[model samples]
Target: MTADLDHPRRGGLWHHPEFRRLWIGESISQFGSTISQLALPLVAILIVQASTFEVGLLVMFEMAAFLLVGLPAGAWVDRMRFRSVLILNDVLRALALASVPLAQWLGVLGMEQLYVVALLVGVCTVFFDVAYQSFLPQLVEREQLVEANAKLQASESVMQISGPSVGGLLIQVLTAPYAVLLDAFSFLWSASWVAAIRTRPAKPERRPDRNLRREIGEGLRFVVGNPLLRPIALCTGAANLFGSMATAVFYVLLARELSLSPGLIGLLGSTSAIGGLAGSFVARRFAERVGQGPAIWISSLAMAPFGFVAPFVQRDWTLALLAFAQGAMWLCVVVYNITQVSFRQGLCPPALLGRMNATMRFLVWGTMPVGGFLGGLLGSMIGVRQTLLVVAVGGALSFLPVFLSPLRRMRELPSYAATV
Candidate 1:
């Protein structure tokens, strides 16, 4: 059966059982993942005593899966049950993360193991994220896409607010390696919730002539050929590329150069989530007021400048400056994400949802590893602060693609058929 895309239920998404379950699981997973985000790099730096480039390499390994198997994974996912994929990936990630704590307890944890774990977890995450995005269109009506994404983004923001603080405290007590165990448990919890989802999406029809390469090409062509999607992809990819570069050594800058404590750094990270939470609340309204298309570019354009503030941060006001910059950056990011994601969900055909989402992710997120490597290289060459300045300037200009596209004229997005 097709989803009820045109008619939204009367009450908010909380009234829907399946969506609620998905939200809860995702919420728990997001919280745990946030902790790992801080804890993992800290493990490399503190426990293994990794250098600046090594830390960046850790980031690279974590996101490198997108560049490797991203295209084929999408074609593969299009032929499977999204919920099953989500559950399996969650379990795999949990297992991978659990290995870190086990190795640490045995006094055998090393940088190499960390790299392996990052790569494994990254591979699992790539699958989970693609399936997760594809699954959403089946879970909720298209009309509820914005509201649903907003609520989900809000939960993620809340996790961002609290997760790092908790992670920092755990690191103080249990140490960074042990702290990752919490994330492992969180993944299992997420898997259970996802498995419990009752509304199963009908499987896509398989054709006898199915070919992986052709399917992959179709996804790529659809994304690159579309007017709205093309610019969106370009804008997001460019933004993420430079954003990754700036953030590659951000913790290093804070902990080593700025000499900030983990607790203070966590606190500053939590402060940034405040803007994400606010943006979650405001994203739907902002889109309605400014028009969805305008909201996409305007939000990005407005927030891009705050990134420049990072290079100027000092010890005395480091907390304030970091919080301000991250807060402003997250605010726009959430709004843009909510608006754009909902549009894409509404635009793509159900048959192409998996491939479309995967292609979009591959295009947008694939730049992360490249940027991470560049960030590390630049940090080592010029200095962390200098790299931040360059990243900021480049990121600010990334919005030019969306601003110049036909998306600027339309108040609302059209479906794939209409666009053609």
Candidate 2:
């Protein structure tokens, strides 16, 4: 069944009370996440004086849960209330983050504790993300999906631009472990906002005969069997894989090879957020003008090649070139993400929404760790620049899957039933 677009809340999404609550909570949570992203590594590096290898392991553990429990988590989320899941996960993450400061103050903060926090937070995040995506369709009209997504992405981009700087300042003042307190507080604030939202759609009826394995298979089949979803998944998965490959050594090349200062590197990093912000603002208009299908593939195909500029960047005007390249790449990514994710949410049946989102995330995001490993290995053998070149070229070609599919010709997405 399609969502009712003529509902009283059908005006501007910003004016929708429940949507505003969700958006505010999400924006705050994302900002906190950015803070923690910086704080986590800093806690290990600055506070505990962790070895380089130990820091790498910390990063690995943080993301490892996605590969471990990603698929099953979706099936589980499908069985529960999305809002409750969201609230509970936020509390869990807040409590998890809170532990670090407590440990630090108690003089018990250690690498082991850091590892545990990373693992716990990662697991909770997996559930939260699955439910978050699944819950959005229930909150807004089908017609508002694109606009809603654009607003959310734009806010997230704004946070990305500013969060790290805020994080750095907090770290300098409060120290790394204490800086994590900001993220803990942010999660609590997010939970409060989420708890205040009262306009949730009714939960899907539960069946007594539900089988986890079968439900997971159904989700997998839906994504793999649908012609439109399949190519999109392949294209996304490829892009993520190669993007991770480049990311593994991206900073090393800048800091070690290019001899850029930390401040300059941070500035360059922030440029992507500017591009992302612009993309978020423009995505809805671009889709309206060019058609969502063409916008999806064309954005990726035309802009991803700029990624090639990274490996060749030098200390001169090339640095600006690098910033532009990263910015352009992110611009395309945010635009494509807003359009495609809205399509997925609008296209999937409510019963399958959680599982579908989870399965796709599994296929797409699950590649990062593997790609990181491969990139590390390739960098060791062929060197960082060559590995980056490989990533740039491969990422550029990732769009081919979607470009060659029926999506290349369509101007608008078809209904879920029609696709099936």
TM-scores of the candidates in the order shown: 0.96, 0.90
Candidate 2 whole-model C-alpha lDDT, 0 to 1: 0.84
Give Cα distance to truth, residue 94, candidate 1, Å.
Answer: 0.4
Q: For model 2, which pairs clash?
A: none
- Alpha-carbon local distance difference test for all models: 0.89, 0.84
Candidate 2 lDDT over 256-306, as tens digits, reads 577655446556767878899999999988988999899999988977779
Q: Which stretches in model 1 have alpha-carbon errors above 4 Å?
A: 1-9, 416-420
Candidate 1 at 231: error in angstroms? 0.7
lDDT of 1 by residue, 1-420 (tens): 324323335677877778889999999999999889999988998899888888888888888999998888899999999999999999999999999999988999998999899999999988998899999978887777888999999999999999998888898889999899999999999999999987786777889999999999999999999989999999999999998887688988988898877777778889889899999999999988989889999998998879888888988766587788799889999999999998998899888888998899899999999998999888988899999999999998999999999888789788655655
* Model 1, residue 154: C-alpha shift (Å): 0.7
Could you say which candidate leads in lDDT? 1
